[model samples]
Target: MKNIVPVKWLLARLYEPDIVIVDCRFQLGNSNSGREAYEESHIPGAVYLDLEKDLSSPIGEHGGRHPLPDIAELAARLSQVGISNESRVVAYDDQGGAMASRLWWLLKYLGHEAVYVLEEGFGAWKKAGLITTADQKVLIPGRFLATVKHNMLAEVDDVRESLGKAGVTLVDSREAPRYRGEAEPIDRVAGHIPGARNFFWAEGRRPDGTWKSADEHRERFAGLEQDDEIIVYCGSGVTATPNVLALEEAGFTRVRLYAGSWSDWISYEGNGVAVGDEKNQ
Candidate 1:
């Protein structure tokens, strides 16, 4: 519930015992890349969470490249990693906040509130001249419970129900070209949900790949109704978490993530995924 903390604040909390820092730096081209990075060096006293091993049920065609694993499995994983209900978690990745926010939203989706994404990520940490260590950590086993909140998710039915309705805003977090159907890297189809606005999550990143200031970010979501409920999605459920965090940071509290995202949405046989310059639509 607190504001997104800086790397320095996280370093200050490094030895708190109740703090859990997960390094999420994964290369999309090679899944094992993150683990290699962690093996080389990571935040002093930080642990590596393999995107495929530690997270997700498994990669599949219908489930996108990475699908949300069952709640019980995730709960058990967190518990196995020594996270408890009282533990405060900070998740981060090198590619802006895309991968980091996945863990952040997963904690929230599984109903854990004490989670936050490292504002800039591992790059920012190294840039700050922070210490790194290759020492492996051993977790003291503890029980962690999650109260799954399904309402925070929006399915195709909910999107259909809200279309043409007043005070409901849809945002696609995919790149502009991808949202326009001009490019398709991971998914079979391009474009986005009809009546959705574009806010490419990568745009929030600076040239150095750190997140922008709250003021500048707030301006990005400007002109939208603060009272309107915001539903955000991307290739899958991952990238959209940054948008959720961004809007929440901007003081818009009525935000939800379409966990299925565009990948899941387009998989629907009859769903409408529009193409073209949908910026103003």
Candidate 2:
């Protein structure tokens, strides 16, 4: 399955039975904004999925702010939303694929390969002058079986083990300031993991929000070999997914997400956190 689907292609197949369009518009601080936006206007046949409610599990002291939902519960939610293993899933959001990529990665982590993030997101759809609707569509539920792909995820232990490993790379996908410990708007600490490198997730896109070409991505990540293990993380594990997608596009195969990321790391009192511009280098 393609990692991205164009707005024109999605418009052409809007009503296909095996296709499921998901509205993933969300605001980090405003929980009700996404649902309210969907209720006001959404693509025909698109169903809403909230980042906090549908995508994340209940936050605890151990996991990050946006922890991964239980596999069984997530699978059940997907089944309830008419998503089977065979469905062609397309997710979109206003935040330049940040929120949508989470859903994209989650679907893949659950062993479903027919999922994609819509290029340019709902903003592009609106800009294209396409049709939207306020009416809701009811879909018959599907029987989606869940299978966990453990290799695609990295826990706090794996991250600690990879800190100074020769063949591993730990990537911090937040902005340079956040990664450098100069400024931290969220989380308790103001720095990154001791040995991690910075690769801002938004760099994957152009100024207009479309993804860069595959060749460009390959060039951006040319330093790494295909066999090297890459572990990506962000403030709370949400934004790092875009970097994971970018790495895959660059032809890097052995990549994993640190789901707890910096938030969970700092929660451990003994964990080492580096604060300074030098740490980013």
**lDDT string, candidate 2, 1-281, tens digits:** 24878899898898889999999999989999999999999989999888989999999988899999988888999999899988999999999999999999999999998899999998899999999999988978988997888999999999999988999998899999998899999887899898888888999998878898778788777666679999999999999999999999888899999999999999998889986654324
Name the lDDT of candidate 2: 0.90
In candidate 1, what are the lDDT values of residues 75-167, reduced to their tens digit?
888888778889898888887877878888788877789898887888888989988888878767668898987877787688888777899
State model 1's lDDT. 0.81
Best candidate according to TM-score: 2
Q: After superposition, how far is residue 84 of candidate 2 from its true place, in Å?
A: 0.6
User: Per-residue lDDT for 64 in model 1?
Assistant: 55
User: Cα deviation of 150 in candidate 1 (Å)?
Assistant: 2.0
lDDT of 1 at 191: 79
Which consecutive 10 residues in model 2 have the weakest lDDT in total?
272-281
Clashes of each: 0, 0
